[model samples]
Target: MTDRLKDFIENNADGFNDLEPSQDSWNKIAARIGHSEKVRNKKLRYISIVSAACIAGIAAFIIFFGKPQNQTDNFAEIPEVLEAEAYYTSQINMKKEQVYQMAGNFPELKNEMEVDLAELDTIMVELKKDLNDNVSNSEVVEAMIQNYRMKLMILEEIKSFLETKTDDQKNTTSYEL
Candidate 1:
């Protein structure tokens, strides 16, 4: 039994030696696989870094320059209208004599005022048309503003007159009472 054990040990020892790879060969194979894995990892890392950098750069560009430029460009393209000025001027130019003549008499003056208001409505429609046609023109924008301003002024004047008339009526009524 001992001799058989010794023979088995000696045979298996040489068998294991034959099966074992040389140290240098094993090292080369290990190094090749390791190097390949390292290269793959490096390439992946580089791609990831480049992608991140590209995204960051685009974001930075949009944040720093794109949004404000777009806003300014949009605003710049919109025509400026001086509505208040136009309304005021138009109101001042309204002919009181014409209004009175249209009234036919004192009682009819209210009707005349209404008719005059209709004229203003016509003027507003024309101004809106002009604005639509010449939206790109600065002069047109200014004219529209002036026209609107005049209209507003006319409205204010009418409002004042109505208030005055109302006050007068209240005073007369109180005196009669």
Candidate 2:
């Protein structure tokens, strides 16, 4: 067993021979590693700089151009009001025309009804202006009530006319029979 161990040691002794690296080779290897590290650092620095510039540019855009001005924001917010105004204006205009046509059909009350409708128009304009100005004028409310009353009066007159015509038809039919 001792003889086998001695032989193994002798055989492996050559593997542990002093094989010192040459100075030139060592320097070359070190220089290559250092150059590669520098290149890698430079690339990382370039990427960081580019990323920083992009972030700065995005921030600048947000500060200067991306955000809307107050007036623009307000304008954007007014579509609801505009839509409501359009709807109200159309409704009022139609009502006005309907009232006028109904009044024209009644020859006896046409002039008086026209005068009332004119008053209603003036009142509506004032009411609209007051509403726009954020002033809750009681006069405007009263004017709206008056307009509603006038419309009711017109409808009453139409009903009376229809009733009279029906009565006249019944009378003529009774006479014929």
| Per-residue lDDT of model 1, residues 1-177, tens digit only | 379978888878866576756669966785777644345435434443443344344333433443222122232235333444444555544644444433342454355345544554455454444444443334334444544444444445444544555667669967995
| Residue 3 in model 1: lDDT | 95
Q: How accurate is candidate 1 locally (lDDT)?
A: 0.47
* Candidate 2 Cα RMSD (Å): 39.0
Cα lDDT of model 2 by residue, 62-122, tens digit: 3344433323233212565457446555655666565555444445445544544464455
Q: Residue 60 in candidate 1 has what lDDT?
A: 38
TM-score for each predicted model, relative to the true structure: 0.34, 0.34
Superposed model 1: Cα runs more than 4 Å off:
1-107
Error of 1 at 40 (Å): 95
